[model samples]
Target: MDRQDCQHLLAALGEYIDGTLDEELCREIEKHMAECENCRVVVDTLRKTIYLYRVEAQEESLPQEVRHRLLARLELEG
Candidate 1:
């Protein structure tokens, strides 16, 4: 797949993770991820982020340093 395909995959990633996508589409994504290291890393990071919010961060905001680091990593820091 080309860069455009990766963008398309990334666009659908949230739905893929939320289990809102069709099984066939999910299979396509998983197949793509299996061969794409960049996509795999993105998917893993997103999954962990979701897990953290649902499990750990649900009780409170992310620890201050973590929030700052995440924001910086996204280049969203002020």
Candidate 2:
């Protein structure tokens, strides 16, 4: 996949993981993931991060450095 495709995949990642995306968009993301290992790794890692955040975050706090790293990786911090 080209850079543009990777950008689009990243843009859709949150909605895709949240199950808010329609099937067509999910299919497109899945197809792109099949062809793009880099994107796949990013998506897989981010998805896991989100899962852990939702499931365990409420019960316990993350290490400050780990949370910072995750936020940085997700581009959520400026």
Candidate 3:
């Protein structure tokens, strides 16, 4: 986190966690995470949260109002 490049890492973090980042970029992120303990924790927590959300999402759908609100908040409404 102390490194200015942490911003670059953060920008690509979602793709990194999703396993969709290009190989060289992924390598850079991995190197940053190795040195930045704070970023590592943040990445780990987000990954776990996403995993749990996917699991719960499979078990039950959100009510329509809630779904709309959530999607709107995420700017993902389409």
Q: Name the best candidate (by TM-score).
A: 3
Pairs of colliding residues, candidate 1:
none
What C-alpha lDDT, on a 0 to 100 scale, does residue 46 get in candidate 3? 92
Predicted structure 1, TM vs. truth: 0.65
What lDDT does each candidate get? 0.86, 0.89, 0.91
Q: Per-residue alpha-carbon lDDT of model 1 for 1-78, expressed as tens digits? A: 367768879889889988999998898889888889999898899899878878975677568999999999999999
Clashing pairs in 3: none
List runs of model 3 lying over 4 Å from the truth: 61-78
Per-model TM-score, in order, reads 0.65, 0.65, 0.70
lDDT of 2 by residue, 1-78 (tens): 368989998888889988999999999999988999999999889888888888986888678999899999999986
RMSD of 2: 12.8
Model 3's alpha-carbon lDDT is 0.91
C-alpha RMSD in Å of predicted model 1 compared with the true structure: 12.0
- Roughly what TM-score does model 3 have, to 2 decimal places? 0.70
RMSD of every candidate to native, in Å, equals 12.0, 12.8, 9.4
Superior by lDDT: candidate 1 or candidate 2: 2
